[model samples]
Target: MKKPFIFIISVLGVILESCYYDNEVYLYGNGSGAVCDTATVTYSATIAPIMASNCNSCHTASSGNGVITSDYNNLKTIVNNGKLLKSVNWTAGAIQMPLGGQKLPTCTLAKINKWVDNGALNN
Candidate 1:
Protein backbone atom coordinates (compact mmCIF):
# COMPACT_ATOMS: atom_id res chain seq x y z
CA MET A 1 0.00 0.00 0.00
CA LYS A 2 2.79 2.51 0.86
CA LYS A 3 4.74 1.67 -2.30
CA PRO A 4 1.66 2.14 -4.49
CA PHE A 5 0.80 5.46 -2.83
CA ILE A 6 4.32 6.79 -3.33
CA PHE A 7 4.32 5.83 -6.99
CA ILE A 8 0.98 7.49 -7.59
CA ILE A 9 2.07 10.69 -5.84
CA SER A 10 5.29 10.79 -7.86
CA VAL A 11 3.37 10.35 -11.12
CA LEU A 12 0.93 13.11 -10.21
CA GLY A 13 3.80 15.44 -9.32
CA VAL A 14 5.47 14.77 -12.64
CA ILE A 15 2.24 15.44 -14.53
CA LEU A 16 1.68 18.71 -12.73
CA GLU A 17 5.25 19.84 -13.33
CA SER A 18 4.95 19.13 -17.04
CA CYS A 19 1.82 21.27 -17.28
CA TYR A 20 3.55 24.46 -16.07
CA TYR A 21 3.05 27.39 -18.44
CA ASP A 22 5.59 30.15 -19.10
CA ASN A 23 4.47 33.58 -20.19
CA GLU A 24 5.61 34.26 -23.75
CA VAL A 25 6.34 37.93 -23.16
CA TYR A 26 8.24 37.28 -19.99
CA LEU A 27 10.32 34.60 -21.61
CA TYR A 28 11.40 36.81 -24.51
CA GLY A 29 11.50 40.26 -22.99
CA ASN A 30 14.39 42.23 -21.52
CA GLY A 31 15.21 41.98 -17.84
CA SER A 32 12.76 44.77 -17.11
CA GLY A 33 10.12 43.01 -19.24
CA ALA A 34 10.44 45.47 -22.09
CA VAL A 35 9.89 44.19 -25.61
CA CYS A 36 12.11 44.71 -28.67
CA ASP A 37 13.89 48.01 -29.11
CA THR A 38 13.02 49.40 -32.53
CA ALA A 39 13.43 53.00 -31.44
CA THR A 40 16.89 53.72 -32.87
CA VAL A 41 17.41 51.12 -35.53
CA THR A 42 20.23 51.80 -38.03
CA TYR A 43 21.51 50.07 -41.14
CA SER A 44 25.11 49.40 -40.19
CA ALA A 45 24.38 48.58 -36.56
CA THR A 46 21.13 46.68 -36.82
CA ILE A 47 20.14 45.73 -40.34
CA ALA A 48 23.61 44.95 -41.70
CA PRO A 49 24.48 42.51 -38.98
CA ILE A 50 21.14 40.78 -39.29
CA MET A 51 21.69 40.31 -43.00
CA ALA A 52 25.23 39.13 -42.47
CA SER A 53 24.17 36.51 -39.96
CA ASN A 54 20.93 35.44 -41.57
CA CYS A 55 21.07 36.41 -45.24
CA ASN A 56 24.50 37.09 -46.72
CA SER A 57 25.55 33.44 -46.73
CA CYS A 58 23.52 32.80 -49.86
CA HIS A 59 22.65 36.31 -50.97
CA THR A 60 26.21 37.43 -51.55
CA ALA A 61 27.59 38.63 -54.91
CA SER A 62 28.69 35.24 -56.17
CA SER A 63 25.60 33.21 -55.35
CA GLY A 64 22.43 35.29 -54.96
CA ASN A 65 19.72 35.01 -57.55
CA GLY A 66 20.72 38.41 -58.89
CA VAL A 67 20.21 39.70 -55.39
CA ILE A 68 23.53 40.69 -53.92
CA THR A 69 23.02 41.99 -50.39
CA SER A 70 26.60 41.97 -49.19
CA ASP A 71 26.91 45.73 -49.58
CA TYR A 72 24.78 48.81 -48.98
CA ASN A 73 24.18 49.67 -52.65
CA ASN A 74 23.14 46.14 -53.55
CA LEU A 75 21.08 45.83 -50.37
CA LYS A 76 19.32 49.11 -51.10
CA THR A 77 18.18 47.72 -54.41
CA ILE A 78 16.29 44.92 -52.71
CA VAL A 79 15.00 47.24 -50.02
CA ASN A 80 13.75 49.63 -52.67
CA ASN A 81 12.03 46.84 -54.56
CA GLY A 82 10.41 45.46 -51.35
CA LYS A 83 11.97 42.03 -51.62
CA LEU A 84 13.98 42.38 -48.46
CA LEU A 85 11.09 42.91 -46.07
CA LYS A 86 8.68 40.74 -47.99
CA SER A 87 11.00 37.78 -48.01
CA VAL A 88 12.14 38.10 -44.43
CA ASN A 89 8.61 38.65 -43.21
CA TRP A 90 7.48 35.63 -45.22
CA THR A 91 4.73 37.62 -46.83
CA ALA A 92 2.71 36.10 -49.64
CA GLY A 93 4.01 36.38 -53.23
CA ALA A 94 7.55 36.83 -51.93
CA ILE A 95 10.09 34.06 -51.77
CA GLN A 96 10.80 33.33 -48.11
CA MET A 97 14.42 34.13 -47.28
CA PRO A 98 17.25 32.28 -45.58
CA LEU A 99 15.61 29.82 -47.89
CA GLY A 100 14.72 26.54 -46.22
CA GLY A 101 15.16 28.10 -42.80
CA GLN A 102 12.76 29.45 -40.20
CA LYS A 103 11.46 33.01 -40.42
CA LEU A 104 13.41 35.68 -38.57
CA PRO A 105 12.41 36.58 -35.02
CA THR A 106 9.62 39.14 -34.66
CA CYS A 107 12.02 41.63 -33.07
CA THR A 108 14.43 41.30 -35.97
CA LEU A 109 11.66 41.81 -38.51
CA ALA A 110 10.52 44.87 -36.59
CA LYS A 111 13.99 46.40 -36.69
CA ILE A 112 14.30 45.79 -40.42
CA ASN A 113 10.93 47.35 -41.07
CA LYS A 114 11.85 50.35 -38.94
CA TRP A 115 15.02 50.84 -40.97
CA VAL A 116 13.11 50.67 -44.24
CA ASP A 117 10.49 53.11 -43.06
CA ASN A 118 13.32 55.49 -42.20
CA GLY A 119 14.31 55.39 -45.93
CA ALA A 120 16.72 52.48 -45.87
CA LEU A 121 19.51 54.97 -45.38
CA ASN A 122 23.18 54.07 -45.91
CA ASN A 123 23.97 55.37 -42.45
Candidate 2:
Protein backbone atom coordinates (compact mmCIF):
# COMPACT_ATOMS: atom_id res chain seq x y z
CA MET A 1 0.00 0.00 0.00
CA LYS A 2 2.79 2.44 0.93
CA LYS A 3 4.69 1.59 -2.27
CA PRO A 4 1.59 2.17 -4.42
CA PHE A 5 0.89 5.54 -2.79
CA ILE A 6 4.49 6.66 -3.33
CA PHE A 7 4.39 5.65 -7.00
CA ILE A 8 1.12 7.54 -7.64
CA ILE A 9 2.45 10.68 -5.93
CA SER A 10 5.68 10.53 -7.97
CA VAL A 11 3.73 10.17 -11.20
CA LEU A 12 1.48 13.10 -10.36
CA GLY A 13 4.51 15.19 -9.44
CA VAL A 14 6.15 14.48 -12.78
CA ILE A 15 2.96 15.36 -14.69
CA LEU A 16 2.39 18.55 -12.75
CA GLU A 17 5.99 19.63 -13.15
CA SER A 18 5.78 19.15 -16.90
CA CYS A 19 2.76 21.46 -16.95
CA TYR A 20 4.74 24.39 -15.56
CA TYR A 21 4.50 27.55 -17.62
CA ASP A 22 7.33 30.12 -17.89
CA ASN A 23 7.82 30.57 -21.60
CA GLU A 24 8.51 34.23 -22.12
CA VAL A 25 9.59 33.78 -25.73
CA TYR A 26 6.41 31.83 -26.46
CA LEU A 27 4.09 34.18 -24.60
CA TYR A 28 5.74 37.49 -25.56
CA GLY A 29 7.22 36.25 -28.85
CA ASN A 30 10.79 36.21 -30.15
CA GLY A 31 10.88 39.97 -29.79
CA SER A 32 12.29 39.32 -26.35
CA GLY A 33 15.46 38.00 -27.94
CA ALA A 34 15.33 40.10 -31.11
CA VAL A 35 16.48 43.68 -31.08
CA CYS A 36 14.17 46.57 -31.99
CA ASP A 37 16.24 49.12 -33.86
CA THR A 38 14.69 52.52 -33.27
CA ALA A 39 17.93 54.28 -34.18
CA THR A 40 16.94 54.62 -37.84
CA VAL A 41 13.20 55.23 -37.78
CA THR A 42 12.27 57.06 -40.98
CA TYR A 43 9.07 58.15 -42.70
CA SER A 44 9.66 56.64 -46.13
CA ALA A 45 10.61 53.31 -44.62
CA THR A 46 9.31 52.85 -41.10
CA ILE A 47 6.46 55.31 -40.75
CA ALA A 48 5.14 54.85 -44.27
CA PRO A 49 4.85 51.10 -43.90
CA ILE A 50 3.21 51.36 -40.50
CA MET A 51 0.71 53.91 -41.72
CA ALA A 52 0.09 52.03 -44.94
CA SER A 53 -0.70 48.85 -43.11
CA ASN A 54 -2.65 50.32 -40.20
CA CYS A 55 -3.98 53.72 -41.17
CA ASN A 56 -4.03 54.19 -44.94
CA SER A 57 -6.70 51.50 -45.41
CA CYS A 58 -9.29 53.95 -44.11
CA HIS A 59 -7.47 57.28 -44.16
CA THR A 60 -6.64 57.52 -47.81
CA ALA A 61 -6.43 60.34 -50.37
CA SER A 62 -10.21 60.76 -50.82
CA SER A 63 -11.76 58.65 -48.10
CA GLY A 64 -9.90 59.64 -44.94
CA ASN A 65 -12.87 61.49 -43.47
CA GLY A 66 -10.75 64.68 -43.54
CA VAL A 67 -7.52 62.89 -42.71
CA ILE A 68 -5.45 62.22 -45.78
CA THR A 69 -2.89 59.68 -44.72
CA SER A 70 -1.70 58.81 -48.20
CA ASP A 71 0.08 62.14 -48.47
CA TYR A 72 3.15 62.91 -46.40
CA ASN A 73 2.51 66.65 -45.97
CA ASN A 74 -1.00 66.04 -44.68
CA LEU A 75 0.23 63.42 -42.30
CA LYS A 76 2.74 65.92 -40.94
CA THR A 77 -0.15 68.11 -39.91
CA ILE A 78 -1.43 65.41 -37.58
CA VAL A 79 2.06 64.77 -36.28
CA ASN A 80 2.69 68.43 -35.48
CA ASN A 81 -0.71 68.71 -33.83
CA GLY A 82 0.14 65.72 -31.58
CA LYS A 83 -2.80 63.67 -32.83
CA LEU A 84 -0.72 60.91 -34.34
CA LEU A 85 0.88 59.57 -31.19
CA LYS A 86 -2.15 60.34 -29.05
CA SER A 87 -4.45 58.35 -31.32
CA VAL A 88 -2.05 55.47 -31.79
CA ASN A 89 -1.24 55.31 -28.09
CA TRP A 90 -4.93 55.58 -27.24
CA THR A 91 -4.55 58.63 -25.05
CA ALA A 92 -7.59 60.21 -23.43
CA GLY A 93 -9.55 62.66 -25.62
CA ALA A 94 -7.86 61.26 -28.74
CA ILE A 95 -9.55 58.84 -31.12
CA GLN A 96 -8.34 55.27 -30.79
CA MET A 97 -6.59 54.32 -34.03
CA PRO A 98 -6.68 51.21 -36.21
CA LEU A 99 -10.44 51.68 -35.72
CA GLY A 100 -11.30 48.25 -34.27
CA GLY A 101 -8.07 46.31 -34.38
CA GLN A 102 -5.76 45.53 -31.50
CA LYS A 103 -3.12 48.12 -30.61
CA LEU A 104 0.13 48.13 -32.57
CA PRO A 105 2.99 46.00 -31.37
CA THR A 106 5.37 47.31 -28.70
CA CYS A 107 8.37 47.52 -31.01
CA THR A 108 6.35 49.31 -33.66
CA LEU A 109 5.11 51.83 -31.16
CA ALA A 110 8.65 52.45 -29.95
CA LYS A 111 9.84 53.16 -33.47
CA ILE A 112 6.97 55.56 -34.04
CA ASN A 113 7.62 57.39 -30.81
CA LYS A 114 11.27 57.64 -31.72
CA TRP A 115 10.44 59.17 -35.08
CA VAL A 116 7.96 61.60 -33.57
CA ASP A 117 10.33 62.57 -30.82
CA ASN A 118 12.93 63.36 -33.43
CA GLY A 119 10.58 66.04 -34.88
CA ALA A 120 8.72 63.59 -37.13
CA LEU A 121 11.02 64.19 -40.06
CA ASN A 122 9.81 63.56 -43.61
CA ASN A 123 12.79 61.32 -44.19
Q: Give the per-residue lDDT digits (tens) of candidate 2, residues 40-75.
A: 889999999999988998999778888877768999
**Structural RMSD, model 1:** 11.2
Tell how far residue 60 is off in model 2, in angstroms.
0.8
lDDT of each: 0.84, 0.83
Clashing pairs in 2: none
**Error in Å for residue 64 of model 1:** 1.4
**Root-mean-square deviation of every model:** 11.2, 10.1
Q: Each model's TM-score, in the order given?
A: 0.72, 0.72
Where does the lowest 10-residue lDDT sum fall in candidate 1? 23-32
lDDT tens per residue, model 1, 1-123:
699999999999999998874643434443454677776788899988999999899988889889988899999999889888899889999899879999888777778887998999988
